[model samples]
Target: MEEQQKKEDGLLNKEETDTLHVDQILRALNPRGRYQILHILLVLLGIPSAGFQLLSNVFIAKRVPHRCAGPPDGSGWSDIFGDTGNLTIVQGRCKLLLTDNSSVVDSAPCVYGHQYKMPENASVISQFDLVCDMDWLARLSQSMVIAGQGVGVVINTFLSDRFGRKTVLVSTSFCLLGCGLAVAYAPNAIVFVVLKFLIGGFQQGILVSKATLFVELLPVEYRSVQSWLSGCTWGFSMMLFAFIAFCFRLRSLFFQTYENDSFMDESLRWLIANGKMKQAQKVIRRIARMNKRSETTILQQIQEKLVLRKENGAEDSERPHKLVGQESCQRLSLLDVLKVKRLLFNSVCLWFCW
Candidate 1:
């Protein structure tokens, strides 16, 4: 009886080892299959839009040469202010020299609105009359975009952790599209700034979620290659953005919308870690099908692993509930970094470098 029991235990251990080998399954499916290539390409489509949005203010808030409107009757500058003494050209841009009824030349603000050398709708500086006293609004708008990105990083990180990465990525992408379109047709400065803030937020969220998904999709050995590929894609996108901005100017903002059709599956590691075995199995099957591999074999292995895990989970359930609950409650916060001296020093150095 003792010899028979030993043989059965050995066989069970061998079966567990065979079924729980994740790397072996990955090798069998071929990590560098057509599905991975296509997925990477599709995810990269959003990089150019991100670059365009980041640098768009350089064109959208561009300063154009302008002077005060002469008169409603289409009078020229020389015709309106005749025989004026030499004034600084810079002063002439904001303040207009006016000859009152007493023949005394006095400087006044651009009372009748400004006339721009370029198209009236060329930039926010000209379109919304943001020059002279209102020029600060243009700078504020640009600053607001950067501020929104900071705020987005925090909020989106939390949301991505709570919800899945794919869900946040798709939602943020659509939100970004809507914000970009709305900004193009904003009626006033307040509305424009508000939309820009939201745009910055959504843009950051998309970036973070996509990056996490991209890394998760790849194997450990190819992560370095993945980083290089991502860097190259981003660099190329930025260069393309520069050319597009040159050719299309502010109109390019409207053309910047590129829809992502292929939604990526959730991270398999995340699903397994969270005990979502059914969802993990579905993702595995989909991956196998896309890679043109035998889904039945991989699914069988995963199903066996799932059964073993469930058996172990049942045994673990009665052991210790209080310790697990307490550990879960002690969540890490940003302030925790300061608790470690070495970590705090490294963080400060990285901040300065950035």
Candidate 2:
């Protein structure tokens, strides 16, 4: 009996030593190889588009010089400096002056809509006639995009964790493309605002899921490099956005969405964590082939590691013992942050910075 117990203990130690974590397996499979480079490049393609979507409104809804319309065609600017005795320009943008024999009779609102000095239908401001009382609608559309981003971060984080990163990333990319196109052709200001909100949400989903997938796939040593690369890409994309806006103006928003539809591989770590052994094996084999490593050896190692992990998990579940206060301590809430002074301060600082 004593010898049997000793043998069981020795086997447990051996199994523990043989079991490999996801990070170790990634490192063994050649983390910084052809596969990683290709994957990183594909992911980076979407970052610039995100920058364009975020800043597109700056050019698309730019304020153009305008004044109230006048008599000749009712769509032309009022002859403020002309010798027109019937109509005169008012001091403010909303009101127009009407006079009889150079004596002010009354001030009238822009009855025929304002005429913009810019090209016809150049911007939402001119297209929707969003001047004076209606100008607030343009500003609201911009704010809605920002509000959508904030909401998307919370929602996509939960969705990615539940349905896997690849699904959320692909779905959001397609949705963003659709929403972007719709916004460009929106028939009214309301439709434009609604589509911009959805675009912002999908854009954020792409960003969150893409970042999570990229980080999880890389080895620990490569994560810092990924961060630096992502930052540089974003900065360069912003600069490129300016150039695109200069050359193409609002037309740039329509083309930026196409690049985000590139093919992307599912994360190996996510597959394994979600108990998708077959898919995980398939991804591993692909990675091995792309990295020019021995597929058979890596597959064998991964299988043994997974088997050991399953056995360990089963054994843990069979155990009926429970630690005191473990159940209560397992969960935390937002209130806990308020309870801790240091945590509260840090949270406030981060919130302010963001």
Give the per-residue lDDT of model 1 (tens digit) for 283-354: 766777889987755545545554766578734334332221122336556677799788899989967975
Question: Which ten contiguous residues of candidate 1 have the minimum total lDDT?
Answer: 319-328
- Among the numbered candidates, top TM-score falls to 2
Give me the displacement of residue 288 in model 1, in angstroms: 0.4
Error of 2 at 9 (Å): 30
Q: Please give the RMSD to the true structure for each candidate, in Å.
A: 7.0, 7.1
- Candidate 2 colliding pairs: none
Question: Each model's number of backbone clashes?
Answer: 0, 0
What is the lDDT of every predicted structure here?
A: 0.70, 0.74
**What TM-score fits each model?**
0.78, 0.78
Residue 302's lDDT in candidate 1 = 49
Q: What are the per-residue Cα lDDT tens digits for candidate 2 across 1-354?
A: 743453333222223222455787788688988998888988888788877888888888889788877656644444433455556556446777756647876676776667788865568888888889999999988898999999998899888877889999999988988887777778998998998888789889999899999898887688889999999999999988777777765542444456654467888777766556567666777888999988666655655665666767845445343221233224445577899899999989978976
List candidate 1 stretches off by more than 4 Å.
Answer: 1-25, 74-91, 98-105, 252-256, 299-331, 339-353
Cα shift from native, residue 240, model 2 (Å): 1.2
